[model samples]
Target: MNLDSIKQSLSLWPTELWLLFITLLGLVLASFINVVIYRLPLILRREWGETNLPEISLSWPSSHCPKCKTPLSWRHNLPLVSWLIQQGCCVKCKQKISLQYPLVELAGGSLALLIAWRFGANLSSLVYLGFALSLLALAVIDAQTQLLPDKITLPLVWAGLTWHWVFSSSQMFDQAFLGALLGYLSLWSLFWVFKLLTGREGMGYGDFKLLAAIGAWLGAPALVPVVMLASISGLLVALVLKLNAKWQGQALPFGPHLVIGCLVLLIGGQELAGWLGLGAWLEITSWAF
Candidate 1:
């Protein structure tokens, strides 16, 4: 077809087709997310002044069964399909796989669809899709191990600042910068205050940076609601754990709650804020840049 005809043909494509494409891309990336979640921690453990840890990396190890150490064939690594077909067992050793694999893929796929629907077919959609995936990885990592890798959260801070500078208004960029600064400072201050009073560190530096990265995206005005949501969710869960005899005294990580708070605020900002009685605060602060 000629150039004009080709352009016209592409434009004639249906919305469902675009959705399918985005969903497939998300699923493919989810496989990689699994790799990052598993290996990134090991890599970090190795790097933190440990001389004997075996070398590992996101790209070098290649996909394999963690138990068997056998490399997976292409068919064996097909996102959610492989897990289902194999009954969540390693093909070589018949080792039962963690349910995390398929769940992450599903979450990634759903996130892709949400981004496509919310932001539509545009650069913001792509940017936010990747952002969402990073948050997903962070949430899972923190929930499982209570560790948030600086490798991910640190770059997230810079990425948010860069994204705004390139694609957002100057005012928005300013908000992002302010958000990062205020985000880190606010949490850092709280952490030290708690430590001083109780002779215990209430949270980690990773949480400070995670909030800072969030601020970089949603701006300083958004910080109050984000923190409030995170605190409330975290408190509720803490209460439940404290009440349970078996789970009492378990330390809860705040990073995953922060991620959940950020996503909920991002996707349902106006409505959610109103429900939480923060709508007036959001408006007074001009929550958007």
Candidate 2:
């Protein structure tokens, strides 16, 4: 019942049992992520239509099989397990389902377990878990659709702020707030400058907000480096896709890079700063050179 008792029980549990639990939890979260990924766009469209724009809904009525009108049963909805058991086909219509569903669930579970192993049972652990799950959802959604829905991004911003206030110290809070402001303003400035210079949009407003959320979680000092790291990673991904002869205008999601950067930060931000000479060494090098 108590925290200590729970912790003790967890420690006493076999590694396999712990892993199974984490995997099940991850699968459940991923199942909900399917809904979020599917519905966020529609919700946004509806909101846009309500504001007087004519955008059609993504899905009307309820979630019925596209091939058959029969509703899915609880037994058919068991995340990756159900899909695996059913051979990735609908039971009613026997239509093949995309592997993305199970893959997302597996990725979510694996990432959750990894974060738990890294951070343990502290508040930081919970934050890391939430961060990983959100990133998993964001990455899948962004890859499937070029859009990064505000339904996720805005809540991520609030979650970061909430975590800082509730779990971190005043110093951490200060860093997070400053990070959010600088992160948002920095991109906004770049967008204006790039547009003015080239008559083109370099990035989206959603990216700015997402980075702000990262800032709130990581800190102000991390903003520029994270942006730089993400840019480089994004370029590499773009290059690979383009080399394979993908369209020039194909949208590349910036969310994954941010997620990767934050994960790096979570795992070893201080060490990375030292290696990159972003701290005392950088100042010394600048002065000497």
lDDT of each candidate versus the true structure: 0.88, 0.71
Write down the RMSD of all candidates, one decimal each: 3.2, 4.9
lDDT of 2 by residue, 152-251 (tens): 7778878887878876787777878887888889888998999999998877887788888888777787776677678778888887887786577666
Worst 10 residues of 2 by lDDT: 280-289
- List clashing residue pairs in candidate 1: none
Name the best candidate (by TM-score). Answer: 1
**TM-score, per-candidate, Cα-based:** 0.92, 0.81
TM-score of 1: 0.92
- Candidate 2 ranges with C-alpha deviation above 4 Å: 1-19, 50-66, 267-289
* Tens-digit lDDT string for candidate 1 (127-185): 78898899999999999889988999999999999999987888889999999999999
State model 2's lDDT. 0.71
Alpha carbon deviation, residue 39, candidate 2 (Å): 1.4
